[model samples]
Target: MVGDDFAKLFRTFEHTAFRLEVRDRYDASYENESLRKFLAGEPDDLPWIQDWLTMISAATQRGLRFSRVRVVSLPLTDYSRFGVWCSQFTNGAGEDIRYLPRPEATAAGLPNHDYWLFDSCILVRMHFDDGDGFLGAEIIEEPAVIVEHNYWRDAAWHHARRREDFATEQRIERY
Candidate 1:
């Protein structure tokens, strides 16, 4: 399954793990309890979050770069806001997180789907349902596809603002 593939890739990648996330809201299964707690104004002290942070930190300490660009729309949705809140933990774990407004991302011609590119070679295109529930991922190893995704990543990265800067601009209160 693609889920297992993602875990394998995450553990075995040699250099960089880059992700481009382009969704406003995700299904309940994708967010469940943490999102509920966040919406209810609870502190972000979730145990699973710490586990993810530990994984990211270990990867970074091994010299593997982790970065992500999240494309968001104006008048943020609840999920987007939660994502911004979660960015604090990920950024602290040495993952470079950034934000790109949807209008800007559209203007730059980036794809609408989400994907993960590992070491600028293996491309894993992620699928989602109409309601934004994760479906799965498809691994694409073609040179041309990889090259195109690499180009998109560079462009998106260039236009995205760092998480801290974006949080300040968006007036998102950091916990």
Candidate 2:
């Protein structure tokens, strides 16, 4: 599942979904304007993630749950700060977003790969370039692989800090 087939999982996952984000920076075409504003220290006139918010809102209303843990460095990068800003909108719309310091995650032996595990069954392993640009994604449904990723998701979730708390701890509100 590389294109539409891959996207269908978002609409079809039965109950839950978890994401493990290990990159300190992500470059996506959709976030270009927001990233620019974040880098230039300017305010965004409108939310860039309206679509994601709407999707999460609808999914949660339907009794579906979504969560994610982002492993980040101690001194947050500009992109990490921008991620904190974006998490605000997503969390408000019913996504559980958390931050895990990279050192702690490394200490725990969590894999550095990024993926989305749906309903503890299917996985979409994301591929990205060295520059943090997304290249493609592959869907995996092997039971053994799913089990391994489930363990990873649970480990990350157990050690992560909620969006607001982590932001406060990092004093991101000053921005």
Candidate 3:
């Protein structure tokens, strides 16, 4: 249930891969340069990011669904702003990326933890340190747990707004 092992699930899912991102920031090494550029008020582009974008593009082209709902706080963090910026590319590549303000997500009774639900079956819970460094992934196979995660996914998706719409709103609020 480590990062590499968890990633293999992406290639094996038959239909859908849904992610519920509850963290305001992820300390993934690959994104550091992009984050730097974002903070410097420069282009958000990072060459290595193309690898993930390509993977997403390929998966969607093969007819699989890719979606994620990020639960963010009202006053956006620098990382959250960067996420909105990156969503443009990810969403354009056919992944349905959405945002849910923390208050709304709380009203929907969503869990604070982050996880990925694959084909409404396997639940991969993400573990991270206080510094936002990813620790590993924990795979859950119980039907009851899967059902609960699935319910959370549905609730989050219902309350989320597409990236395009949310980005505009964030720009207006600038919070």
Candidate 4:
């Protein structure tokens, strides 16, 4: 549902003014074929995905200064190359960085325990359920909402364990 909005949003925000605070998986489901394929080492990199990375890399070049990167939940494994991607945008010194998970859901709940934060931006959740019973969201933007979800992610992060083994690999750049 949000795919179209994201498509348009991506185009608008792909430039310097726009920053991201991704909470859940950056690329999840077959719907995000461009990102998934690129992550899977497919030959073609999606233009939007590439643009997204380019923005992040550009932000990094500017000393990793973004509005914010609040990670709430990470469906993707911590050991995955995704961490390497995060590092490229978050950690520049190349030192292993361990996140400080919130002990509980913050007063402002969004989603994800990992909690990627950014300021002065909008969010759109793409609900991909193949059922007429549900109205899948194509774009969602509201303040004082998504509190329950954000709480859930915070709870999970508190209970979640860090992937020490994967963190080691990240330090070595094996991924």
Which structure among the candidates has the greatest lDDT?
A: 1
Q: In model 4, what is the error at residue 37, expressed in angstroms?
A: 14
Model 2: which residue pairs collide?
none
Tell me the spans in candidate 1 whose CA falls farther than 4 Å from its real position: 28-30
Q: Which of candidates 2 and 3 is the stronger one according to TM-score?
A: 3
lDDT of 1 at 171: 82
Residue 36 of candidate 1: its Cα lDDT? Answer: 89
lDDT of 1 by residue, 13-112 (tens): 9999999999998675646788988999887576667877998999999999999999999988888988998898899998999999999999999999
lDDT of 4 by residue, 1-175 (tens): 5346445543454322222233333434433554455367555423434555666456556544333333333334443345444444333322223332332224334343222222223444434233312233433356644444344434444543343443454452322
Alpha carbon deviation, residue 11, candidate 2 (Å)? 0.5
Compared with the true structure, all predictions reach lDDT values of 0.90, 0.89, 0.89, 0.39
Candidate 4 colliding pairs, count: 22
The window of 10 residues in a row where model 4 has the poorest summed lDDT is 112-121
Cα TM-score per model? 0.95, 0.93, 0.94, 0.37
Tell me the alpha-carbon RMSD of every candidate: 1.3, 1.6, 2.4, 8.0
Worst-scoring 10-residue span by lDDT in model 3:
166-175
- What global local distance difference test value does model 1 have? 0.90
TM-score (C-alpha) between model 1 and the true structure = 0.95
Per-residue lDDT over 16-109 for candidate 3, one digit per residue giving the tens place of the 0 to 100 score? 9999999999988888888887888876556867987898999999999999999999899998998898888888888999999999999999
Structural RMSD, model 2:
1.6
lDDT of 1 at 14: 98
- List pairs with backbone clashes in candidate 1: none
Clashing pairs in 3: 76-175
Worst 10 residues of 1 by lDDT: 25-34
